[model samples]
Target: MKIFMKILGIAILIAIGVGFYFRLNDDVLTGDRIIGIAVLTSAFILMPVFLYVRWKGKRLKDYTLSEENLKKMRDKGID
Candidate 1:
């Protein structure tokens, strides 16, 4: 599942790059292209990466402040 997501994310990113290339090269800009880019970026790129990492047992709290983290920070003079 994780491998599949990684592949999907890469594919989406490539599609976005291609979309931008064509849109920028053209003389006329359309609302559809803008909307398509926005939706693809969020749904395909961001969502897949988020889900893949979460599925790997990573938690948001692990990176945020907690008693153990605070204590470590203080000891390291970073607090």
Candidate 2:
């Protein structure tokens, strides 16, 4: 899973770079399409995968603000 995420991230970044290269040196329409597709893929596919990988097996409440958590933070001298 870690290796897959790394490869996906690198591939997306490469696609974006290629998109920019095409935009600068080739047809504007093709370049824009490539860039748009790349951006959409990152937002929809890459982000969710990354989030799942990072948050897997973690309790959501631990990261959220609740009265109990707030009190704990205050006791620790955190604002």
Candidate 3:
């Protein structure tokens, strides 16, 4: 439940970011409406993946996939 809320929050922020980006430059943009919508849709969709990768990368710096980390107990030995 907490993870779901976090993801939802991330998604809303991304949506606002994308909306602001487009709103600011809408006048300069030139293309068919269909093409424009397609671009925006894909870009919005990509934001979540980008965020996930960023989050995972940050977590990786402080953690590892070794057996010790997997067990998540300080007393456990990797071997």
Candidate 4:
């Protein structure tokens, strides 16, 4: 999964770079379409997979602020 994410991220970045190259040379419309598609793919597909992989096996309560967490923080001189 980690390898897959890395490959996907690199591919998307390469696509964006190619899009910019095209835009600078001649095909503005095609470049724009490629850039748009790459951005959308990163946002919708790559982001979710990355987030899921990173967040897997983690406790949500540890990150969220609640009354108990606030008390603990105050006890530890953080608040």
Give the candidate number with the greatest lDDT: 4
> Which window of 10 residues has the lowest lDDT sum in candidate 1?
26-35
Ranking of all predicted structures according to lDDT, beginning with the best and ending with the worst: 4, 2, 1, 3
lDDT by residue (1-79, candidate 2, tens digit) is 8898789888888888888888899677888888899899889988998999898999989999999999999999999
- Residues 1-79 of candidate 3: C-alpha lDDT, one tens digit per residue: 4466467556655655665566667633432343455456556755565666568637563576776566665556544
Query: What total of clashing residue pairs does each candidate reach?
Result: 0, 0, 0, 0
Per-residue lDDT tens digits for candidate 4, residues 1-79, read 9998899899999999999999999999999999999999999999999999999999999999999999999999996
TM-score of 2: 0.79
Clashing residue pairs found in predicted model 1: none
For TM-score, the strongest prediction is 4
How many angstroms is residue 36 displaced in model 2 relative to the true structure, after the best TM-score fit? 0.9
How are the candidates ranked when ordered by TM-score, highest leading?
4, 2, 1, 3
Q: Over all chains combined, what TM-score does candidate 1 have?
A: 0.45
Runs with alpha carbons beyond 4 Å of true place in candidate 1: 27-38, 44-49, 52-79
Error of 1 at 10 (Å): 0.5
Superior candidate under lDDT, 1 versus 2: 2
Q: What is the lDDT of candidate 4?
A: 0.94
Q: Is candidate 1 or 3 superior in TM-score?
A: 1
TM-score, candidate 4, is: 0.86
- Scored against the true structure, residue 36 in model 1 reaches a CA lDDT of 83
Between prediction 1 and prediction 4, which has the larger lDDT?
4
